[model samples]
Target: MTHAELVFVPILGRGHIVSMVEMAKLLVGRDPRLSVTVLIMKLPFDSDFDSYTSSLAASVDTARIRFVHLTCENTDAEISSASFLTNFIEGSKPHVKRAVAELVDSAGSTRRLAGFVLDAFCSTLIDLANEFGVPSYVFFTSSAAFLGLMLHLQSLQDEHHVNIAEFKDSAGELDFPSFTNLLPTKILPSIVLTKESVRSFLEHAKRMRETKGIIVNTFDELEPHAVRSLAGLGAPAVYPVGPILSLDGETKKKADGSCGGDDIMEWLEKQPPSSVVFLCFGSRGSFGEEQVKEMACALERSGHRFLWSLRQPPPQKGQIEVPHDYADPTEVLPEGFLHRTAGLGKVIGWAPQTAILAHPAIGGFVSHCGWNSTLESIWFGMPVATWPLYAEQQFNAFQLVVELGLATEIKMDYRRDFRMESGVMTADVIEGGIRKLMEEAGGERRKKVKEASEKSRKALMEGGSSYLSLGRLIEDILNNMPLT
Candidate 1:
């Protein structure tokens, strides 16, 4: 029997890399005849995935799933615009081409080239796939709803000549086929309002149409309307094979062990069931001292048990802004705030989010509305108070609050870039949102999230929606294998 290998090119970010790798694992695990070769593109700055990749390589079967790290020249140039990602990926074209050629030559007739699974940011690599005479599929790391919005916005620009930048100033709601409710302009991703970023996203959306299919990291049940709308659109076939999370916690567990793992779990164990609220932004989420003070005041006033992951914004290395643990969180936090909320609140530098959410004590989450965090919150049946900061997080927050009614709103339009000018969320607003999350809307949101959690798990089981979709995707890959 001839073996087949699908080449996966994932973005360098932790969330994207982990999710795509999990998808690759699922594919190879489901079919013994198939294998996956993930082309790891290292970012110019330190992304700190060395341990993760090393651990994963050791744990997985290398024969079936292997990681090929691509070498690119390092640049110390500062990345101030959104085009950096596009430019970096474009620059790696020659490296990608060389890697693919080497893989083809090494396989000879023993294994056939199946196809290319491109990350959302790497859509430009589709042309490379075309040159290699293999089908290309996009592994979109965000929600299906966001995917629909991207395509819709692209069409609006291409066909209708509608300017998305105008939405920044307009106080109007736009209707998109992907969502059931009217979307307010305020909730549009901050990137869409900027010329360069919008151009980059639109270009990605345009090229994504050239792929054989677009695989979204979402399940049908979670975003039914968005998933259904994609089918009617004229774009390529869409496969919703997800909630694809790295549930094993291998990478995080290692990090957690070094960072007072016992202390966090021990504190949680002491709290009463469903009483403590967890306030964690995504990995990149952090705030200025002004905002941090307000959050501390709010958590104190709310009189609820809490776990806050307060991180300091690391100095800009390149384009990416990673948040690091503060040497002393009290430096940024309010005076005597830690002492005041000592028993009720535990403010830590880094948190084991999934582990915390899984604990019985976690009642609700104050989250950044990042797709991975959103899915994890749902998986653990935790109601969320959306506090989106950057990227597509504002839109994700809106989808959860207004479109799906699964999350309560903290501040849907808050963006990191415009944080100072956007005005600090007052202590009262923060307190009210936390109260609403843990008390008022908690029951209904918990019920819905619990239901979604159950369906999400079932979706991966045999005979489930995601299972069938993955099977279909694999069949497509097998059928598209090049003849030797």
Candidate 2:
């Protein structure tokens, strides 16, 4: 057999790295002749992914899937700036170049160097891949809808010269090729309105056109319109091979036992089937005292069984926010709230989200609309109440609530931008949203999610859309292999 090697370059965050690794795993598992080399980059002040990566390394076959940590040099640039990720990835080009050179040298003729898989944020590295005479593929970690939106917005700026900043407060709806429904300007992601952030995003979108293909972390059944729209865009060929998730929950258990995996499972087992509403934000999701209090008030008034993952914001501001567990839940929550809703609700920090969503007792999800969380909810057939915070989440909320009708909207425009002060969402609004979500638990929305869940699973089976896409991707890699 002619061995082939593909190099994967993922961004520094946990979400991006994990998803990229899962994709690599799927690739190697599908073909014995292929192997993957993941080049890991570390952010200066972020939480370490050592334990998680170490655990994964031990469990998997080391020969097929290898992780190489690059030596990243610190820069004087401001860590909290919007362009931090881009700048960091750009600076690490030398390390990436050296790693790829070493891999090619060691492989010789027995294993041919196939291609480079770049993260969405790491598009600048495409130049380096070109330097080494290898094809590059982008691994987009968000929805295909979001990818289409990025390309659309890039066209708007490049061809039409439209200033997106002018639409900061516009109350109008705009049509995009990816979405079936018109998107309201109010629900646009907070990042797009900012000059610096949008510039970075558009730059990436433009560079994405130069890649061999873009692999999105979504299934075609879940976003048929978006996937089809992307195919017609004349950019790069898109491969929708996903619902790629870390479902085992072992990493979270090993990383932090205090995340309460066993305890949460025990509590869920005691509850009636399809009765508890699970409220968990993504890894970086957290809120202020006032917002936390209102959430408690709404949960108490709704009279529904609930599991809330409440995390406290970092002690200082103007830096990267790393939310931690509150010493006492009552400090941030309403006074006597825990005692009042003792049997009905359980508030813990750092929940095992995948496990919780998979449980039979979980009826609905109040999520931040992160792509991974959205896919997990769909995979488990849970109805969602969209409550987005930061990044592309606001746009995701709009897609879920207005476009797909798969989720009830808590607030499509709510954001927690560090640069500005967003108003606290009041208790009545949250209570109303919660009431609507629980009422539709067994209704049309639930039916749609269940059907999507089935399709999502089948998409990965042997003759499914994702399975075929992966095969095509592997063939493309082999065809692009550099001649000896």
Best-fitting candidate, scored by TM-score: 2
Segments of candidate 1 deviating more than 4 angstroms: 59-62, 75-77, 250-260, 316-319, 418-421
The TM-score values for the models, in the order shown, are 0.95, 0.96
Deviation (Å) of 5 in candidate 2: 0.9
Pairs of residues at least 3 apart in sequence or in different chains that clash in candidate 1: none
Q: All models: lDDT?
A: 0.84, 0.86
Give the 10-residue window scoring lowest on summed lDDT in candidate 1. 250-259
| Deviation from native of the Cα of residue 206 in model 2, angstroms | 0.2
Where model 2 places Cα greater than 4 Å from the true spot, the runs are: 251-259, 419-421
Please give the RMSD of candidate 2 to the true structure: 1.7
The digit string of per-residue lDDT tens for model 2 on 1-484 reads 7688888998866778878989998999999989999998877776646665677667666588888989965877777788777778878999999999999889866687788899989999999889988899999999999999989998898889998866777999999999999999887777778776778878899999999999999999889999999866656989999989888764245345454578889999999998999999987888989899899999999999999999988777656656877878888888889899998989988888898999999888999999889998999988999998888899999988888878999998888866444689999999999989988755988899899899999999999999999999988888888876
